[model samples]
Target chain A: MNKKYNLAVVGTNFIVPRFIDAAERSGYFHLHSIVSRKTQSGLCFRSANGYDSDVVIHENIADMLNDDKVDVVYLASPNAIHFPQAAACIKAGKHVIVEKPMTSNTRELLSLIALAKANNVLLMDAMKSLLCPNFSILVDNLSRVGRIRQCTSTYSKISSRYQGYLDGNNPNTFNRMLSNGSVMDLGVYCIHPFVHLFGSPEQVHAYADLLDSGVDAAGIVILKYPQFHVNITHSKTCATTNSSEIQGEDGTIVIDNISTLTSLKFVDKKGEETEISAPQDPNSIFYIAQHLGETISSGLKESAVNTHALSTKVLTVLDEVRRQTGVRFPADDR
Target chain B: MNKKYNLAVVGTNFIVPRFIDAAERSGYFHLHSIVSRKTQSGLCFRSANGYDSDVVIHENIADMLNDDKVDVVYLASPNAIHFPQAAACIKAGKHVIVEKPMTSNTRELLSLIALAKANNVLLMDAMKSLLCPNFSILVDNLSRVGRIRQCTSTYSKISSRYQGYLDGNNPNTFNRMLSNGSVMDLGVYCIHPFVHLFGSPEQVHAYADLLDSGVDAAGIVILKYPQFHVNITHSKTCATTNSSEIQGEDGTIVIDNISTLTSLKFVDKKGEETEISAPQDPNSIFYIAQHLGETISSGLKESAVNTHALSTKVLTVLDEVRRQTGVRFPADDR
Candidate 1:
């Protein structure tokens, strides 16, 4: 009999359908349950994908994690809820995959990691970015640049919602209590990629433009490594950028888009450049599914790509950035 | 008889010869004196292009400004001295043309502006970018895209001297106390073009990558206006970037090099791009010299290209950015 791991997906919204699609295509995992904060979201999740009725639907984390049929918990909730939901899953003996900006702050994430380890549960930060084939290629090829002198990464999206925020119509994204600004949202993407390439920085300095609600609408952060430095910036109320560029002693490596896996190029100091492309995956969730399957099947304690420790480090940087900029979410307070 | 204005040029480094060349070429202004802080620099200034001994050499600002032979003060000193020099010139009944980052801070500039107004003397920020013919063309054609939306400007130079700073050479260009860093050095070039075209930003937020000595090695900042935003970035100890881009409601105006004032293009919403290359002058200093001649001849109270208030505004923003990033220049205390 082919072993089928039962997977439970939580918080069905902008990303949930894609996750479900990838899970369905994987065939290694059985899509078992869908959980949302409300019944309508669960129905929307089901209707959007025409999901099988065999899958359970739960409105609350306690009910969902308590269900024995669910072996893996994927908490793709709001910026504020990742920690509590993931901890609850770990306590209930389910492997956890929480979305990026894993917890509102470092302290919350540390507590969750402690609980997960104590319970012997596999906890991953669902940062599929580090797991992408293209990213792996870039990291492998980074040494071609000889020695990295500096790197600059930018991720900016022109949010229609920001226009609404300015008009006082919709303000959740601008709200400090939701951790719904550019740094926590987009800048987090820049942080992990740089951290994955060059370990935690020796010194970190950030300058964020605060919104009316005291959250960062846009921000730039510098991570000073031993040999070089990484300059990262993100803005919710702006438009596109050249993703990320790593400049070194010999050449430069540029990734067109960091938010999603895309193309990259290595340009040598002599101006010789080589392009590296990723085998296209229609759904962004493919990497996460593959990582989870490999981690479980190989009996590996955890996938190094999204290890708990790396998540903790990223969370620590986030905590310091928030402290410096004075951005806070309810979960951070918790 | 053609009215001739007498000018005193300060600082004898890279830009002094260019200013002297322009002044000598112009029939409107006669180079009266060349003041150098060091005797060696004064001799170098005299030997350059065979400048005559009649050009008075003063070692100090008080002596240069007090000299009745000098009618206008052309300051090319390090960033730290621009404020005091301009203030002293305004006090001494001479017009002033101080180099970029007009002063270290806004308060110093405000005081100078008051003094200039009281003395009925012309004061201008000698920004080559604002008066460039190519920039004027860009500004005139910017509104063709209807209403403006977004902009990204970058001015970066890979300074071998910054490497010297890393080697602990302590060059004035990398000096933290002189307000010398990537942003002030390069980003001021980026800001002049953007601000001249789009006008002052309603809000400004900066993200600076501070070097070991507390200078911004590289940084990115966003200038928020009413309808859209402008992104400005620079790095002295890093790679380079394109000059500037102004995106509008219908299209985007991309300038190949704002500093050089080279090629330009208008890309519309449907992706039709119209490239327009402006006539380039081998010597980029011609535009400023022409402006200086016209402004002085017409007895204009302020320069149209580089106005006093606009220069003051830019200095104020730089001050706030330094304050937030803890970039305390030696001049700040003075």
Candidate 2:
């Protein structure tokens, strides 16, 4: 139980509180600092989340990276800023954990991976679902289902800020300039698990309902594999059943809440039900933080579970889906 | 009620028994004749359904169509035989009810509509789902949900005979030569209701897992409209949840089985449930039979509920999906 790393978190959005909670729960990582553009809001957020009064608070990335005590930086900034922010952390010799979508495009992600290797610092995508203990249980039970035939995953919830957008507000989640859209914001949850379960698809096809803001409000992506096919539907404009199903020749697996993966049920041909449950922390970020801490302690440059290769494959597929659906972001030009 | 129209059935497949039962329940249609390549199977089918012994049995379509007493013909033949058989019945001045995926392509369906008009005989595509009394209730309750945002319909069931195909027996349901595939055989149930609920989509995009038989074993079609989007997924290789959902700004409508539409539940944003139930006849085909008989008695050349126009629209979308998926039929050349 060598829990002795100093971790700093970037971004003050809704995810900052969860990341702080994850760090505190890991028991191996200390919340050494936080970087936010508004120092007042940063101080308020730190106190609200019960961070120690002595925790360093910085208003910019440079100031936080200069802190020699910070060994790991968890980046949860906007989509367009992920590459530059993570590159800066790695260049400063700090391990990094990025949010769901590592970067806006595959080229940026590839370059970041190269830079991390050059700097000899670990770079990992904080895809919490893959890091959960239950996900390994699912992977272990895949053989019981026999030959896979089809998979359908859906993640849709009407955004609370959607009404504001409809009333003519420019929220970051719906802004193309920020590299934000339904695919990047919501569909990433589906793509990560898909890539983790099955490797890169042979072909990718997608269709979307693009909003006037130049971002997709809803979309469906079809991933064609050699033996099986996957269909992922996601939206920010409406809520759905939010259930995922994988059908095989001998049995089927039904997963509720693919993002959290709280419940899994397997049904065989004889209609026998088997419930597989695992330890689920109230805060999902705790699992990813624990895994990241352990991997860093062992001197690993990437996660064995949320592998760099898997993140790259997911980003590549998402890039293609965005291109096919005409969801262009400012970062795409670069 | 006329209760006197003479009805003739073509094809001795499993659906013929259901058509016989529906006619018996309609009370307006009498089973006067049956057409089959082998009259022995037709006799057995008639006897199994308890049809009167005096019912005429014909070995050819011409003989049944020429019978002056036959007022309507129900063509339940394979996918490729629908157009020619329905056209012949129309030319013989008998009303016709053709099973779904009425023909292999839209061109044949359009020609049938025109011929039925010229002959002054009622022509209809027997899509029982559209004619179900519960369907009308759903249509009437659409406004309660507010402006529509998205709809998802799935009708996937592993065909009972799929094992035969897997074992190297080419059943008609899985045979490309007979113009039979998952989309044509099972997807029509989803497409028909989609068109009935929302008119023809502006664009249709599809991806499929084509079997070695040159037909799709499973596939998904995305229908894009101006205000809303629809996703229809159908498969013959496996069974699914078999549910349909329509999401709107204020509420959602869910149907247990889109094919039979036995249960409908509406949920609002406040988590209130409204169970809307309608008259659900045990025999679904009875609704279509009753509608067709009444429309013909009124001297209408097409059904208002299952209109020739609506049928053509659905087939046109189906044709586009087939073209995208490369599920070609011999009749497609014509």
Candidate 3:
């Protein structure tokens, strides 16, 4: 029999409901609790989702972590508080899945990894791209393109909150204090695939257009591998069709919406295209939920797909990019 | 009546025949003379292209220029010799059209500009992209995409000469002494359109994958404008569909092939794509030939479309790219 673990979720953002629904539908987990700064919002989220009366709502993260019934906590709060919230969950001996830009920087991520091991709890970032079935297929079919020379991956869309920011409001997505910026919120989606597919580049150079709030509005990063180059362009101030291409010696692979792995096709030397086939889910978050659920069921310390090592390397690159772009968060010093 | 100028061509490469056909078809110029290192090749080129027997063939460049009937000289020689050949034409008091990467460096370009003035003749580089009818449409439609935040333009084709280079032969295209590299050849196509569209960028950064011959096999260049970023990725080592995009605050412009401007469309915030329509020619080179003939007939000393000032800015940026990539030619020193 497949054991369904009890899952607690933090925050009440759009992503939170999606995560909760995916987690329960994967048949490996159920919504066990909710944590939010506002008690009313947590209750509203649980009621709206029809999670029943047993789903506990905690206004305090510490009080939420004290619940032994919660086997794993998913952190989806603002970019700033992921570290402290995940650390409290880990110290309480519950497995934790922190959302992307896993923590403020490499320092906080490393600390969480250590604390998770000390408390004998699993730790993983919600890096769902790698867990998606299409990622493996994309990597497997890369040879069809011959010796790769370059990959251009991009994800850029104006945030719903951007208009407010332009109207002289300080949204958390553009707040320097919250460790929120384009590189963190959007660029990470572009970076992880390169790291997963090509490994760490020999050199990383980045140029960013910073908002007046001292956060990146948009940026271009050039990652120079020994044999090729990978360019990552991400923005919260602009939008694109977001198609990407991988150039190779004999052919090219065209990927539609790389962040989603929407559709992929390879054009050979003769310019004939071969459609790459792979299984895809409407909500990719479900794959990560299943992977984490399976990991917790097997008593594993971390997810194999979203490994600690991968997160560490990604965060290190993120730190280097921030250094190059001159974006430092108050959380980084913490 | 518009005067059809008498034109002479030096070298008998593939582009030479194409230029001859376009120049004549445009009804603005007729082949007047031919000069080549080998007399037979020049004679063969004229014969194969079906030029009249009166189209004079000269083994010596000096002999070709001495023909008073030859009003303008079109240089189609190896890149390294463009400087010397163009200078000789300008010194001989004849209008001249040199191919792209006008000279090895900015110094040579500036010198030729001054020399053309002193010699009282028209001087121009055959930069075809700006002359193409579609380019004007692209520039004019920029507002539909809103304020541009980024542009990724690439032109990479695995050259037929690459196999020879891999088979341990030094093709002039990969030869260091010939001022030949991917940037000077293929990358030039990607750079010119950006300079024409956005003017010059404030900063340039580049990375190259160099061949054993000490020339770039492939490269990525970052051009940082004050408000946006432009990325140019070009290679002779690899091939791609070579589609590109201009990302803007409200929309994106998708280009099928930037080097050719084969197709373009604007995707708005609602994701509705509007196909951008413009005049396109099967042989796009005809546009440049017609413009050059018209410029000479108008008694202009230089091209307004492919201005010397634009060429200067482009060459300056190219020099910076080479500096960053550590690609230098023996011709640059000369």
Candidate 4:
């Protein structure tokens, strides 16, 4: 029988609910604890989930990591705190699964990688999209389209929070000091597929229009490779068709959305079109959840799904773009 | 009666036919002479069009421009020859119309502009797409869609000649020394709209995968503006869907083809879609043809349609992309 793996859930806002629900469905995993800053909020969450009254709720992360009940640490802190918390967890010799925009800077990510190596533990950037089987199928079928000439991918969502900003309230997401912006939040989807398809870009250029709060409300990035080019657009202040197209010499592949990877259409040079659809797992987040379980159960140090090298490259590109556009966060100065 | 604008046609290639046809269609213009390096080709072209047989065909451009009958010169030379030829025409007090990839460099274009000012004659880059009615519609309606966050444009075509080159033929289009490649040939279309809309980028970072001949077979250029970003991709060694998307905060405008501006669709948030179909002009080439007539009739010394400043900016970007990617053209040495 396979060893059972348990996970300590971290952060309890926005995307965490989906993560928890997905973990529940994956038979290989068990949720051991939930941690958050506010004790009342953490207690409310634990009670709602029928967790024990004495469930570990750590206001201080260091205390949580030292607890014998916890086997792995997941960091879902704000963009600025991700680095310090992740680095601390790695130092504590605990496996870590951090949410996307993994670390604010590439240099910090490198340090964490070194620490993970020394501690003989696992560290993964939860770029969940790359782990999806549908994405794997798309990667396998890229050659079928022929030589890729150009690519355009957009992942844009209109933020209702902008209305608050306009009406005189600051949502931390649009605040530049927190490293909160459209590119960091939404463009990760755009960058993942390009980096996965083509290696690192030979050169990168960014054009970004900033919001009043000095954050990149929206932007476009161009990544040029040896045989072709990729164009990435992301915005929180705006909305888009939210589709991606890869144009090749012989045919073109169109995907409806960045996540889910549901609709795929292949159009040929002669203008004939073919549609291909496949059923996804009951929960779309199953891929990453399963990977975490297997890695922990087997006592493996790392995951092939999210490599340190790939994460570093993505961070490097992200940092370069921000530097070029003058998008400085409080963490950047530090 | 309108002023009769005398024009000289230079080169007898693919574009020359369209120039002559458009010139003939304009009642305000007269085809005074046609010049070519080979007397036989010049005479053949003239006779085919039933041009006045007594019209002189000169091998030397200086002598041809000295003739009182020539009020303007049309340059459709090979990519490498544009700078010197356009400069000579400007020096001779003749208005000039030059084809795309204006002068291979910003410095050359600036020199031509200086000569045109000294001689007091019109100098146009003949960027027909900027003058098209469809583009005008796009520019006018841009603000109605809300704040534009990103613009992604692609222009590509399947060149049989490139196929022949891959099969071991030395086509001039792929020749690095001639400043002939996809960015100059097709990517110009990609940049023109961006320049027309947002002005010049503060900084440009471009990367290209060079062909064997040291020309950029395909490339991506990112133009960074203060508010938004523009991503452009162009290729000649392959084919593409050849469409563009102008995305804003509330909705996105999809254009089927930038080259012809054929189809458009407006898609908003909540997945609601509206089809926007404007009637297509029978001749997509009319913009340049009509602009030439209007410029001549107005006795304008220079045209804002394809002005010298705009040409300089576009060439500056092209040169930068080439410089970064190590694409060297013969004209760079000059």
Q: Pick the candidate with the highest DockQ.
A: 3
Candidate 1 lDDT tens digits, B46-124: 9765887777778888888878877787899888888878888888999888877787778788888888899988888
Q: Interface RMSD, candidate 3?
A: 1.9
CA shift of B8, model 2, Å = 1.9
Candidates sorted by lDDT, best first? 3, 2, 4, 1
Ranking by DockQ: 3, 2, 4, 1
Candidate 1 wrongly placed segments (more than 4 Å): A24-27, A36-67, A141-150, A160-179, A198-216, A222-230, A247-251, A267-282, B1-123, B133-153, B160-184, B190-233, B242-284, B309-334
Off by over 4 Å in 3: none
Clashes of 4: 4
Model 4 in CAPRI terms: which quality? acceptable
For residues B1-334, could you state the per-residue lDDT of candidate 2 as single tens digits? 5657898999888888888778867777888998988989878987887889999999999999878999999999998899889999999998889988888888999898899889998888888887788887888888877767778888777777778988999888888988899888888888888887778988998878888999888888888888777888888876665368887767778887887889888877555888996758888888888888788778888888888788889999989999998989999886
- Output the lDDT of residue B217, model 2: 84
* Candidate structures ordered by TM-score, highest first: 3, 2, 4, 1
lDDT tens digits by residue: candidate 3, A122-217: 998897888788777788888888878778888888888887898898988899999999999988988888887878889899989898899998
lDDT, model 3, position B100? 89
TM-score: model 3, chain A: 0.97
Score residue B155 of candidate 4 by CA lDDT: 80
Please state how well chain A of candidate 1 matches the true chain A, as a TM-score: 0.94
| Candidate 2, RMSD to the unseen true structure | 2.2
Q: Interface RMSD, all models, one decimal each?
A: 4.4, 1.8, 1.9, 2.8
**Clash pairs (backbone) in predicted model 3:** none
DockQ of 3: 0.59
- How far is B151's C-alpha from truth in model 2 (Å)? 2.7
